[model samples]
Target: MLEIRQIPVLEDNYVYLVHEPVEKLTAVVDPAVTDEVMSAAASAGWTITHILNTHHHFDHVGGNEEIRDKTGCTIVGPRADRDRIPGIEIELGDGDLFQFGAATARVFDVPGHTKGHIAYWFEADKALFCGDTLFALGCGRMFEGTPGQFWPSLKKLRDLPDETRVFCAHEYTQANARFALSIDPDNVELTMRSKEIDALRAHGIPTVPSVLAAEKATNPFLRADQPEIAAQLGMEGRDPIDIFAEIRHRKDNF
Candidate 1:
């Protein structure tokens, strides 16, 4: 079994420690800083052996060199952005399987927020480490990818099993929930979820590690193809991608 720990750092960013016990192998996913990641690993009695980065964003790969130098961990990242990834030793692309001990992650080149962004899906563990691609109730703003490239990227993730646990790298759920409720105000599920999220945040609890099933039902970005969502935006009968773009534009300004 892979033991996962969530380490909150740098404003709203989340750094994850994924440990495979039998081999005593642990991988840090998207470490924005080194101290928090190292501290978390020490607390769990695990040594960091690998650093898995999803993109070249400074916040995502800022600690790559520090962590690698400190632990001598191999750094793995998107093959498409090799030039940008610091200390990248293993370049992974779509359909590649990255093995960490007995746990293997199937890589998906899920770009849109960035041209070379990727997500890691560990099928056996039912866990997805998607950095800035998909979020609890929103998605990362399209900076380096076109709508054409972004929507399909989202679809790939939306098609995952409903039970998959989504470990996106931020704590933007509450704010994203507000935006979701604005356009999807009539959605009962979203309304209920917003309230639940409000309660969770009220107590200083993290709302991440959201289930794919819950996200599919409530995340407006994932439901951009649904007829009701299109209708709500007054773009009835438009192409799903067009509707998706409009929704994304609205959220960008929201």
Candidate 2:
């Protein structure tokens, strides 16, 4: 079995520690800051044996070298963009499996947030470590990929089991919820979720690790194909990618 813990740092970023107790193995996912990761591990009497990078973005891999240097942990990242990630010892591609102890996470090529972005899904544990590709109520901006490139990537994630717990890398839920409400005003589920997010953020609590089911219902990026969302965007019977592009453009300015 695997145990997952959230380590919030850098004002809004979240770094996760996926641990396998049977072998005392831990993988720190997207370590934005090394000190925060190390301090959390030390507090729990855990040693980071692996450093998992979801992308080559500075926030995601900023602490890669530091943590690896401090704990001698092996760095694993996307094979397609190995040249960008820091200290990549194992370069994985879509459909590749990364194993530690008895736990294995399947890698999915989820580009859009970044051209080489990837996500780790541990089906056995139902934990998804998606860096910046998929967020709570919104998706990442098309920084490196086009709208079409980003749309299919989101579908790959949306198709995951609804029960899967999505561990995203940022605390943008409140803002995302607000944006979702603007676009999906009649979505009761989203309305309620936005209230909950407001309360959580008001109290300085983390609003991450959102269930896939909840995201499917409330996240606008994932709902781009829905008739309701398309109608609101004045796009009926249009290609999903075009609707998705319009949503992204609105969000970019939102």
Candidate 3:
């Protein structure tokens, strides 16, 4: 079985640890800070063997070299982005399959959050390391890719099983849902979920690792075609892509 836990660091970043109990091996996704990651891994009694990166953002790969130096783990990421990242031992691309004991993760190139951002899908575990591609109630800011490129990138993730547990790189749900309600005011699902998230944040709980199906229902960015959303944003009858762009634009200021 794959045991997953979130290592919170640097304000809102999340570094996830994926472990295989039988082999006592562990892999981390997006180690934003080195000491926090090392401390958590030590506490868990697992040896870090792989460092998986979704993108080259400083906050995501900042710990790459230090962690690799300490653990001698393979640094895995996009083949095209080797220069941008440090200590890359396994450069991968779309459709690459990686194995860690009984667990396997399939790579999907999900650019737009960054041109080379990728998601790791472990089919058996129904888990996805989505980086900043898909969030609990929103998507990532487009840094290196256009809205056109970003749309298709998100569509790839939308095709995954609804039950898949989405592990995003940040804790942005509370704010994302607040913006979501500005567009989807009457979405009872969003209202209820936002309340739950508000409570979670109040208690210092992380509102992440949300189910894909729940996001599909409550996330405004994912509901680009909702009549209410379009109408509220004055995008009625406009191209769906335009509506998507407008929603992102509004959220940028929100």
User: Tens digit of lDDT per residue, candidate 3, span 106-149?
Assistant: 99998887888889999999999999999999999988887787
After superposition, which runs of candidate 1 have C-alpha atoms over 4 Å from their true positions?
none
If scored against the real structure, what TM-score would every candidate get?
0.99, 0.98, 0.96
- Please report, in order, the local distance difference test score of every candidate based on alpha carbons: 0.95, 0.92, 0.89
User: Compared with the true structure, what per-residue lDDT tens digits does model 1 show for residues 108-184?
Assistant: 99989999999999999999999999999999999999888999999999999999999999999999999999989
Query: Per-residue alpha-carbon lDDT of model 2 for 1-254, expressed as tens digits?
Result: 88888998887899999899999999999998888899999988899999999999999999999999999999999998899999999999899999888898999999998999999999999999989999988888899999889999999999999999999999999988888888999999999999999999899988888999999999989988999999998999999999999989999999
As for candidate 2, its clashing pairs are none
Backbone-clash count (model 1): 0
The candidate that wins on lDDT is 1
CA RMSD of all predictions: 0.6, 0.8, 1.3
lDDT of 2: 0.92
Per model, how many backbone clashes are there?
0, 0, 0
Cα error of candidate 2 at position 196, Å: 1.1
Instruction: Return whichever of 1 and 3 wins on lDDT.
Output: 1
> Pairing residues by index, what is the TM-score of model 1?
0.99
